[model samples]
Structures are given as C-alpha cells and as structure tokens.
Target chain A: MDTLNAGSVSAMLPSAFPIVDKDWELADTYTLHFATDGAFDFDPGQMVMISQPGVGEVPISISSNPDVHDRMSLTIRGSGSVTRALGRLDYGDVVGIRGPYGTPWPLDTAIDQDLMIIAGGIGLAPLRSLIYRALARRSDFRNLTLLYGSRDPQSLLFERELHEWRGRFDMEVEITVDRSSPEWMGEVGLVTSLVDRARFSEADAVAMVCGPEIMMHFVGIALTDKGMHPDNIFFSMERNMKCGIGLCGHCQLGAEFLCKDGPVFSLSRIEPLMKVEEL
Target chain B: MAHIIDIDGLDGLIASLKAEFDVIGPIVRDGLIRYGPIGSVADLPRGWTDVQEGGSYRLEPGNTEALFGFVLGPDSGKTNLFPPRAPMWTYREGSFSATPDSTRPMAIIGLRACDLAAIAIQDEVLLNGPYVDSHYAARRSQLFIVAVNCTTFATNCFCTSMNTGPRLESGFDLGLTEVLDDHHFVVHVGSEAGASFLAGLDQRQATSDELAEADQLIDITANSITKRLDTTDIAQFLADNLESPRWSAIAERCLACTNCTAACPTCFCTSPVDTTDFDGSAARERVWDSCFSLDYSYMGGDPVRSSGSSRYRQWMTHKLGTWIEQFGTSGCVGCGRCITWCPVGIDITEEMAAMRAEVLAKEAR
Candidate 1:
C-alpha cells in the first residue's frame, strides 16, 4: 500500500457519492441517502450537492449526523427545477456529490457551554444534525435545548426523535406551530415565543438559530432581550447557492460566499449581510 | 513591459496578429454590433450608434464611417472570455469524464472602456478572489484585449458613477481613442502585444498636443452621458429604504420575466439543473438564472422573497447596494441594457433619484 500520503489519502476520498436511498419527507420535500466509501468525512451543518442525470445540481444541507453513519443524508426541498427533479428520485438512483462544504457548526466550540437551538420548518433539517451531534457528545456541553416551530403539527419532522429528546432531564425540546388544531397539545405560537419559557445563563451560553430569516430575526431579538450577546448568537443563511464552491457568485452576501465563507456565521460577524437589502 | 508603437499602425498591427490568433471585433448582428470574429476591416460595422440612459438603450445608424458604431453592446467581453455558461465536468458510468478543451488563444479588438473595466472587475471576482476560477484564468491568460475609449456616451450609460468608462485607463494591451477629424487614432500601448501590433502600423508619434486632444475627447464623451447615479452611500440608502414604497411600486409593474438579467453585463447569478438519458447516463447543466424570478429564493416548500415586491427589492438591492458591499463595486456597468430591456421600462437611475428625492423630502419635513 502507498504510505497513506496526500495522494493516497486523496485517492481514497469519495468524489462521487451514489444515491442508495431516497424518501419523501413532506409534499415537495425529500430526504436522500448517498453511499460514500466510509472515508468520506463531514461535520454537521455542512451541505452536499445532489445532481440528477440530464437535469442539474442542487445544494442540500446534510441532515444526518456525520459521527454515526457510513451513509450521508441530505434533506432537500423541491422549489427550483433541480430540486423538483430530485423530488422524483427513487431508491438506487445516483446523484453527484461535490463537497461536504462550508464551515461546519462549531460543535467543538459549544463544548462546556450551554446551548440553545431554534429551528423553523425545513431550517430544522440542518440544525437537526448539530442537535444530534450535541446529543452524541452530551457530556461535553452543560445545558441543551431545542425549540422547533413549523406551519402545523403535520409538518413537524423527526417526531420520534423530538419525543426521545424530551425524556432526558438534561435536555429540553419544545415544538410550536404557527397554527394548530385541538388535537395538538404543544405550544401554539411562533418559535420565538418559546424563548421566554426556557431558563439558562446568558453568560457562557451560545444560541444557534436557523429558520426563516424573519423568524431568526425575532428569535435573535428575544435572545438579546434575555441578555445574550450578539457575539453568542449564530445563524445559518440560505441563498440561491448554485455552485457550492463559490465560483457562481450567486450565494454572495457582502464579501463572503455563503458556500465557502459560511452558511453558518455568528450574528455579529454577518451583521453587514443581514443589514444589506438582498442578502 | 516592452517596445512602443505609434497610433497610426493599428490596422497593420491587427492584420499581422491575425496570422497567429483568431481576431474578433464588434460586428453588426441582431441589431447590435456585438463581438465576433472578423476576416477583414470591411467586416466591421462602419456606422452604428446607441441611445442610452440608465436602463435604456436604442440603436441607430451613425454618421461617421467608423467600424465600431455602438456605444456599448448588450453582451460584455465576458461571454468571449468567461462564457455565461460552461461545463465544469461530466460524470459517466460511476466515473468522471474529461471536460472538453477550454483553452484557446484569441485577440479581441474594439473592446469599449466600460466593458474592459467590467472584465477587470470580473478578474478580481472570478480569477483572483479567494478561490480562483480556473476556467476563467485559462481563458484570460490566452486572450488579448484592444480597448477603445468611447467617442460618445449612451443616454443610459453611467460608467462615471462606477468610475469605469468613457476613457480607457488600465487593463488593456492597447488603448485607442477615435479622432476622425485628422484620420488618426490616438493610441496608447499598454502591453507587449500592443507594442508589436503598433509596430506593424503606419503611424506617427503622438505629440503632447495630440495626447491632450485625446484627453479633451474623453472628457467630452464622459460629459455626454445622460445618466448618473449617486452611489456614495448606496448601502445605507438600501438599508434605510427597506420599507420604502418604491419597492412596491416597482413590483407592481414587474412581470418577473428576467429580461433585464439576460441583457445585464454583470449579473452572474445562475442555478443548476440535472437530466438523465437512457441506459442510466446522467448530466448536470449550469444555466443562467436571475434573482428576479419568484422561485430563486425558495426554501423548504416556501419561498423567501415570495412576493413580487420582495423579489424586485432583492434584485435592485443586490445590484446597486449589496453588490458593492460584496464585490467592492456597483454591479452595474452603465451599459443601460437592464433599463432598456426591462419590458416595463423600470429605470434604475429613476428609482435612485426617486429614493434620493424621497429622503430629502423627509429631511425637509
């Protein structure tokens, strides 16, 4: 065997990941599984490109935790032409994977610090990976809380995991909906509303919030009101990321490419992009 | 970095260079003089003109028997050097396929100052940014550019605000300002290729008076522009005007057809789509996409900027304000095609003026 040098290590890297499984998560939304040669490594919150034959590629955030599985998972929403085509894929179909790209969630940074995560709708998909990673290394962090909100009760994802996470006294998981029926027993309001009900020290605490921009804004405001510093808040941005490698200029927000510089950034660091009109 | 050549030797210089590389220049096609290969000087459009203003353009036949007639073309030099769409790689049978050869040496002639500046800006974005666009670098290395100072500004042109055009300053192998009165072009040799090209021409040494005339001409051309944008505090303007009624007004007339993006010189937004063939073969395509489209910002079965108002706001904000914060320059080149092709004639300069006036009115109140 070649002495496991850069060339040898690179040769073993998974350049193309084959689609082995796919499932519809909701109407026009999908969860796709790709078989990578176990050597393929990625941290949670990073995204991979899924390409369809004769159609095009769409960047899907890795929904599954990287520490536990040999196969990588991507949660994609059908909106544009590419995702619309991906929504039609079945098992054993193949899609190209470009990267495990972008700055991974600072799971290592969150160690020993209390964590508060707020995810809305599909935004929960990327946050779920971080949540799972946090659970895997639960002893490393102090307090863990997940606040999730969606359009309705039927649209909630990973319902079983939410129930399991709630059982642990060390962790708290709250699910809210914009609108709910009588059968729904959880909180009945936006995810931002749940912040007041949780208890945590603003010092040595960080909040990783991902969701609709408007929802994230409201959540950030709530966190600030609770004495969380802007530097302690993090959010993942969503743009029309055509090329995950930053070549296409589509995902640019101020000098940063959401693909290369960050899809995840501190609220303070990305303030310019947030303040700018289009980004 | 090499020898100097006189201004009169330009035609002979291009002719000599044609033997070694494909020489392309502006030619009349599709109602405009767009960049394409030329066999001889006769193939160039002799008399053409454009009426331009912010976001507006109209072509008219010109009086002077000049080869390059239009003020600026719809397509910038980008399509020649860095095409709108290109194949990165193709995968087949569980393996990657080799992309076709993208290397080629070509000489581009009659590139306007604004277009040349736009190319330089793209170089910083695509070739010299954090991650180099290898494809663009390959094309950029093998190409030669001959910059032409504008004789007149189009009505829609606003390169002055962007500090881009009406005069050629840098980033060219050769620069030429048309001076038909004396049947001479005041030329400036900027590179070795330019020096060699000028060596073959029958030209006279440029005197201080001649150079001064060129300066005066460039000043006149710059002043002829009918449009100007105050971009001094554009980022702050957009930030403050997020809830401005102008966004809704613009959206009310917008069809979201994306024609403006198609004609824009700096709009580089795109989206990828995939396709499969029989026998399990597959390919992915990089297609030009616009943020003006309603679906460009969709996430999780819901659209961000879903309303037409939001989409229009995104487009204008990205172009005039956010782009500056991102690329260190306003994305507009003052080419004026976006205004001309807007279908609804939603001029960007007018929008800026309205916003400026609105701000002033509020301050007065």
Candidate 2:
C-alpha cells in the first residue's frame, strides 16, 4: 500500500504492481481513466502501458493534458485484455502504468507558424494536447485549423472540449463522421477528404497528424500533393508498446524505436519505415 | 599457438572443462540435436549425426561412438550470448531503472564452423555496428568456443558454399577433429584465456604427422558433402529480382509463421513488450518478439505489410540483400537451419534458385 510520490526513488517501485482507477467510456470506442497515482508527467501524444495482473500489457495514449496536473489520464478502447481490465476498474482501484514514453508535440518549434492538426477516431487523444497548447498561446501562431473525423458520431471523442475550443478561439474546427444520423449537418466521408477541401499555405506550415494508419497514409500523400514539405509534416506513430523504454524493440520501425525516438516523427524520417513491411 | 591432444587425453580435457564452466554442446532433443547446458561429458549426443544439403536434412545414425554427434543445431551460440528474451530496463510510477543480466564465462563445446561464421557476422551487426549492443558485448566477452570439424554435413547445409564449415579453420579457442579407431581432437588456443585453459589439461604437443592427419580428415569431410549453392552471385541475384514473380510464388508457400527467423542463428531482430503488476506501482518488463509477426509494423492502426507476400519479401530481402548493405556481410551463413526446421520445408536455396532461373529467363528474352 506504499504510495509513490514525486520524491520517491525509482528502484523502490515494485516489479508487478497495479493501481486500478475508475473508467469512463468516451463515445462508444474511447474508454478513459487515470492510474491510482496516475499523475505522472507526460508529453502530449506519448503513451503509457496498461496491464492487468495475469493477462498482459497494451499501449494506451494519455488523452489528458500534461500542463494541467501531475496525474495522467488515458483514453482507451476495450479491444484487448489490458483495455478490458482497464475498462472494468472502479474509482481508486488500480491497473498498471509504465510510460509517458515517446515524443510529444513540438510546442517550441510551432512558434510563429501556421498549425494544422489532423486526427481520426481515437487519434484525437494525442492532438487534443496540441490543440489545447496552441489555443493557450494562440497569438504565437497564424491560421490554426483542426480537422477531425471518426467512424460515426458515437465514436467522436472529446466532443464537449471541441465545442468549448470552438467558442474560445478564432480558429477553424471541422468535424466529420463516416456515417451520421438524421440530425447530421456536417462534412462527411474519410478524413482525407478534408485535406483537399481545406486551404492553407504549405510553406512554413507545421501539420501534426494522427489516426488510423490507412487514413494517415492518404492524408500524408494529400499533404505532399498540396506542397507541404515532408519535413514539416509531423506524425504521431501508434504501435503496441510493451516497454515504454527503447530497450523493448516492440515499437521499433527500422532503426528508430518509436517509444524512444518518437511517438512523433517527421514524415521524412519515418517514410521508409512506414513503407517497409513488418518494420 | 596450435597444440594437438591425443585420443586418450580428450576425456581428461573435457573433464577439466566440465569442472570449470557449465559445458554446453549439441545434445539430442525432440528428435533433433539441439544445444543445451550439459553437466557431464556423457550428456553429448552419441552415435547421432545429420546431413545438411540445400533445403534438405536427415538424421544419420553414425556408427562411430562420437559424443558430439549431429550437424549444426537449430540454434547457435547467439542463443547463449544474445538470448531470445532479455530485460533491458524497467519503469514504474514515473521512475526509470535499468539492470543488466549478461552471461558469465562459459564453454560452448562442439560448435560447427558455419555457426562460428554466423557469430562473426552477428559481431559486425551488434558489436561493430553504428550502435554497439552492450548486452551482446558482455555475453560475447565471456564466451569460450570449441569448434568441431564437421565429419558429415546436414541435408540442407551448404557451408562449403558459404565458405564456413565441413572444415573449421580459425576463430575457436579449441578445435576438435573426431577420427575413427582413436578419437583425435586438435586443440588451437585463440586467446590467453584459452592458453591458460589448455595448460591446465595434461595433453602432449601434437607432432607434424598428427596435424597432417587432422587436415586430411577435414579435406575428406569437405569432399563428402554433395549439395552446393553458388553464393557468388546470390546477393546480386536477390537485388536484381526484387519485383520478380518468384516473390509471389514463394510468398504463396511461405506461411509467415516466422519459423525461419526463430531457427536462424544470426537473426537478432526482436521486439519488446512492457508489462506491470495490477497495482500500477511496480515496474515494466521487455520481452522478445520477431519481425515476422503482424504487429511488428503496426503504426497508427494499419500495418504497412498487410499481405503475406510483402512480409515474406521483407524477411528474405532483409536477410539476403539489405543485411549486406547494413552490416557489410550477408546475414545468412548458409548453415541451412532455416530450411530444415521450416514446417512447410520452404527451402531458401530452392527459392533463390527459382528466382535466379526466372532472372535468367527474363535476361534471355
């Protein structure tokens, strides 16, 4: 029952411990929660390992903002054992947490440049931090746009936050779902469609992207076609991470260890690894 | 310096080695000779051997009572040096920690010449590469190799084509050549540790005639192997035929089950997984994984090599083509382990020959 605080030494942490916290389902796909002492500092777009006692470990994105507090929050889908166990945890209970691993959004580099954030499905979790960061210092950048898409309306995450964001800044936000209900009145289709529709200066523009792999591929192609430099296009790679550290080669793509080298990488750096099969 | 041990002194030498380090060599396991930790000299597989040819392997009941019986095993000394699973670091509750669990000094008895060549290739990748693997360096530093001259080749073995085995030349602390009537073992000390090791054994110096006998034995062994694959043009052949229809044909047979990688002596690519206890207060663990798995390339939500064809192509290309570009040598030692243990018996040599033939056909047209 020893609670590790900020000053606690690393070697003191137990080998196999869990802090099962309460779970909150965001939309139909996104499930959310914090670790027991989930307040670990993490960069935006970086992930954490979630595991049950006997089952296994799975990589999950920290959906919450690092600037806000010390406690980390994760938005996950109940797809596998760790996620399912994570979904079942009640408030103050415990599960495993082992990261804040991978590179986050380059906030310092985004200064004075146009920012374009593209996200799909749960991919929004990583971009939400960038959105919040940009908006907090909105005057630093010119022309901010956030394009979001998901499978359906029920799958859209952070809807309330997006609504709040729209009201607060002089920014453009577009939300699209693959299929909508009778009340639907917005752009619909794949998220890549928005790439062609949106107008932005490719030069000096830093575009951050996340989402399903297929959608990212198309979006990358579309952005390149639109005169965006591959170097300027940053992507948060999503992979199943077992060790948050670079030692575990699970999240490896070619020479780069995604857990260490990046959760975020420039398109120019990751192009070959992305194209190579089985990485 | 090279010193030869008489047949009678081989047991005493082995006995001394057994007392010092955990002696490991080829032993009978699951109908095959696999390398395992051995406590006694008797644990070595007796009267068992394998013949290796291009994409073919067969167990041979050797009439000679040779303790180190068998061709190159399914695994290599790499398993002992760089294990399938290793924990590099552990993290818990926002704290990071690292612990190194490397191997101590141990003797690997009865190592084949091809596997030794494979280890040399591995050294280039792990030690002499752009980034030195500290774990591999630690384990390799403590290794004591006993290279065994191949009396017979495995069915799928083409080490002669690879210029490795059937006759072992160097890179062993001690070398053995088993002959009928009197089991003669030639000892060559490669390092100071080896010199100190041999000095402890009561073996007399080898005369020039005994050395000639060892060479004759090796020459005979080299000539007995029937299969041969020309590796001179293999790298060029593979590079030229990247998009050839042979890839698809081979892919059709390749199960993508990753048996070849698992059996390969020098295939060191691995992925790690992190796990913690249910309480989240504990640490993280890294486990071993293979490149052939579906999730190896899982970026975002989709895999780049979604099809079996691309996966197979990637595996072979990396082994035969890109490995040279990266490590300055072909990744395969032509030990033929991949062909033998493949559940489908998908012979790499056959695959290469098929591809080469296609290339030839295209050139003719």
Candidate DockQ values, in order, are: 0.29, 0.11
Candidate 2 per-residue lDDT, tens place, B1-365, comes to: 45767545665666777665667777788777778887656677878877654345566788788765577767787777777776555555544455445344567988888888888988886667334566666667667788888766666777777777777777788778776556666677767777877887777787787778777877877887656675766666665555677767877877888878888988876654455566653433434466667876664456656777777776776777667665677888878888887777888777777777777787899
Model 1 lDDT tens row, B42-126: 7767777877644455678888876555676777787677666755555677765534434446788888877877787677676
Score residue B75 of candidate 1 by CA lDDT: 72
For residue A96, model 2's alpha carbon misses the true position, in angstroms, by: 2.6
Best by DockQ: 1
Each model's lDDT comes to: 0.75, 0.70
Instruction: Give chain A TM for each model in order.
Output: 0.91, 0.87
Candidate 2, residues A175-230, lDDT tens digits: the string is 88899877777878888889888878888788899987678878899999999999
Among the numbered candidates, top lDDT falls to 1
Worst-scoring 10-residue span by lDDT in model 2 chain B: B280-289
